[model samples]
Target: MAKATIKQVAAEAGVSTATISRVLNSSGYVSREVKQRVMAAVTKLHYQPNAIARSLKQDKSFTIGVVLPDISNPFFMTICRGIEDIVQEQGYHLLFCSSDEKPEKEEQLLHLMVEKRVDAIVLATTGGNEELITRLAASGVCFILVDRRLELELSESGAVVDLVAEDDVYGAYELTKQLILAGHSVIGVINGCMGVSTGQDRFVGYLKAIHEAGLEHDPALLYDGHFTEAGGRAAVRYFLQMAKPPSALLSFNNKMTFGALVELTESGRDIPGDIAIASYGEIEAARLLKHSGIMYVDQKPYDLGIKAGQTVLHRLEKGLDKSLDRDAASPEPEPIRDILQPALKTLPS
Candidate 1:
């Protein structure tokens, strides 16, 4: 059987080849009705574009590299799905890697992505390779920083780095404030690494609420959970051994929340009865465990992923502009920082 071509697809869709190109490449504006028609025709004919030929003509690999801290985390997985959905429409492939929250591992994976010559990268950085990331972006590698931001001044190098992340400080403040409103004086905090941006911002928020509520600064109530299940469990164990155990607990992320829950259950403690709990992020399992009155801030990971994908597409489009004379008086394109607000969810008593 002969392979279907673009010409046939355009003819079947009742549109010009240019229109077909625009739709297939996801480059220009095309009406939803026309897009649907073109897609239907392509599907009916089982049309497949020659990726090698396209790559050669365009000088693009049509591949996007994605690096996240933990692949096992459902939050990251949802983000990946959003990115895949967006890039796939533009005929781009994804090369995914997990850094395991290690800066060394993240650097290695990033180097590998550069070696692979991916057209762009979406990274949830481990927050330790600021220089390397800045250099790569300065070298004209399109990057969309997802869920985390680098502290270095990338704008100085004229590097195009876009950031799409939730308002971590605000979310943490709201979550912690919810516990405070519930009349908890000693609130235990299961925190992630203090070095990371999210961790630092969340800790700031927690402290802000604590101070605003006139709670004393108790160093012993804070436990570093490192954003892991084990860390969460260890924090609970430590809290239990404290001379004055906290009546309420606040976990920084979903993984730590799970860990804390497990520890509490094993210790024969009733959730929200003996000890109240709140989390900075949602636990997917809570939906299954009906009536689990866990107060949490819904970070909307899937939506965040979608926004990141859109940002990547926008950056790639801008990068394709050959008309701009860089050495001329054209001003540098400012880096985009998109901060999304997460909703605080409180269950009814």
Candidate 2:
């Protein structure tokens, strides 16, 4: 049987196709009675709205592109779930891509999504590619940055795209202070990639905490792990080989923390016994490492995701229309920035 079309639904409901569209899109004002009648006809006809047809008519794909660094990371996965909860309900689909922490790859993925004409893109950028970003902004694709924001050309024009992230600097400072209070002055840090703001700010927090405690901040005690498990393991190796190894270690993130654990366990170094360790986020072995004195900050990744989703959808629904921004000089909508404060949680030793 041929599927019921919008025209058929309008005829059945005794209304214009524009009225049916208003009801279907839930946009504009429609009388409650008219809405009910339209829906009744829609149900009676078993008519399904064709997204493709709507896209062609409205010049919108009704799809959101989500590009992040690591797909395997549980934090990002949970964030996606939060975004999905809001976006899916509003008749929007999600197009997901993982950049694997490479700047060029991130740019490639963004370009591909732009080509596909996604209504908006939620990106956790790798802190590179200003040229690409400039082009994307000029093209007028709505964008929201999640977890990390790159130091690109957007801020120069004061073109702040929507961003949702944790307070990494304060969270890191708070975490380090706790370690200091625990009586560890000589602390070693396994830091993540310095390319992104999260990495740079978190390290800054560690420095602030160390200086505040009046502890000797040794240059040799620092290790750049490049935000990888292998980097974490290498940092541990370097720390263990030190003539006077740090009594306490701070892993910048969850993945690095797990790597630190692997090194500690393999080398027969007892946790909080031989050395103490903590991190900014939870590890995969959080359960098994319960008695290991591994601390983490609850960043509420899922909540952050939901907020990011809300920001992008609001921009799409309210700010812009299907008519793309052709003029570069027009004052774009102010970008929204929401930062959730992180709380420290310690796993008992």
Candidate 3:
């Protein structure tokens, strides 16, 4: 038996090969009547498109590309879960990739997604790839910036295709403010690599809180981390070795917290006894602290994902609804930078 071809399907559907091509490639415009005919013909012929050939003709692969900084990060994993939920339900496949927080890697992935002609792309941006995103948008492929704000233009353009993120500055500021109010004068900060948006924002928030409290930044107590256990461990050691160590510490994420805990334990330090600790996110070990129930923000990756999925689906449906034509008044929903508030828990002092 011979393999089915576009020609065969085109003939069966009573449409030109070009019309079938448009429907298949998801490129250009095709009248609904013709699109349906092509689809029917495709079904009738039981045609299976050659992966390479189909990609060439339709310029689309019916898949959503998800790019994250670090897949291992719990926060990102939660976001991935959210993205996967919607992509799977919508019958679209996901092409998940990690940039490892590198700009070059992010650029490479963006190029690949464009080349593969994914239906759309969801990115936790590395900030340096704004031009790449802009160029992709110019090419008419839908892309959303997740986790990080791309730029002022991307946020305001309403051309962003999609957006879902947190109110990082405010959340971080509030978190740090709590530590100050707890009466810790010398506070040590464990910051994630400052290259990313979340890292920078959180750092800013920490500074804002300290400044508001009339505290000056101390170089001896500030340590930048890789947002992992190793980085956390390193920061803990750095702070402890200082002649005048901070009376309390704050970590940027859960992984860092884990490392910080390991170091503190090895050094025979007691939580809130020798020093107090605060972290940005939840970790299992946090409960072992003087107060486990409170402290750290609940970023809510699951909820964020659910909302992001719904947002993308709404956009997709709007695109598919003939009545909601390209010119229709359904303004692309406002870019949602969903900044969730962090909950504070206390350790037994």
Candidate 4:
């Protein structure tokens, strides 16, 4: 059987094709009664609106592009769920892409989003590509930053566009403080690569905690891990063989934490007995640990995702007004940045 068209639906509802189209798109003005009739006809015919035809007519795909650093990361999945919830309500689809922490891949995905004419883009960008992001913002493509911030050209008009991130430094500071209170004098840190803001901020937090606690911050205890399980395991091995092995170990991210656990288990080392282990983020690995007093910080992934979606919708509804300076008292709705606090959780001993 031939699929029902907008014209057919309109005829069934005793209205014009334009009216049916308006009701379908949920754009422009249509009376409540007319909307009900159109919807009734739609249900009766089981008619589906052609997204392509609608896009051509309205010059909108009703699609939002979500470019993530790594889809395999469970944290990103939580954020994706939040984005999905908001976009679905508006009948918009998500064009999801993972850059896998590769700068070139990120660049390609951004270009594709522009080419596809996505309504907006929410990206977790690598430290590279400030110029491309700046250009996107200048061209009026709604862009928002999540998880990672553009370190360079951040002050460049429209470079960041919008931002939603955790208080990385603070979370790290809090985590480090907890270790100190546990009487850990010599602490080892498995840090993420220093290219991203998260890594740098975390290192800063670790430094602050060390200084405030009046403990010597030994550079030897620090190891730059690529935020992976392998890196965590390697750091553990490096620290264990040190002249004075650290009494406590801090893993910067979940992947590193995973490695730390595996190494401890395989090497027949007891956690919280021989070496106390802690990390930045909470996951099943942290939850299942035998040590009841394990400490970590939660970045509130779901909230960050929801805020990212809200930021884009606000930009869409109110339009991007870059003319308004943030320094001003009554600034226009320029690029909004939301930084949420990370919650600290300590498992009972």
Candidate closest to the true structure, highest lDDT: 1
Residue 115 miss distance in model 4 (angstroms): 1.2
lDDT of 2 by residue, 269-344 (tens): 8888999888989875866864787777877989988998899789987854325554666665666879899999
Predicted candidate 4 versus true structure: per-residue lDDT over 126-218, tens digit per residue: 668778888888767888889877765444364438899998999999999999998998899999978788899999999999899888777
List residue ranges in candidate 3 displaced over 4 A: 1-60, 154-161, 288-294, 320-337, 347-349
- State the C-alpha lDDT per candidate: 0.87, 0.86, 0.77, 0.84
TM-score of each: 0.83, 0.82, 0.78, 0.83
Error of 2 at 196 (Å): 0.5
Candidate 3 lDDT tens digits, 1-349: 7888988888888878878767987989998888888888788778887876765655556688888888888888888788778768877778889998889999999999877777778888876877778767655567677777665575344455466777778778988899889788799899987777888888999899999999999877778888878999999999988898898888888889889988988999877778777888777666765543236766778777776776666656554332324676655545445555555655445
Candidate 1: how large is its RMSD?
A: 6.4
TM-score of 1: 0.83
TM-score of 3: 0.78
Query: How many clashing pairs in candidate 4?
Result: 0
lDDT of 4 at 117: 81
| Best-to-worst ranking by lDDT | 1, 2, 4, 3
Candidate 1's residue-wise lDDT over 296-328, tens digit each?
998888888889888888888777232446555
By summed lDDT, the worst window of 10 consecutive residues in model 4 runs over: 323-332
TM-score of 2: 0.82
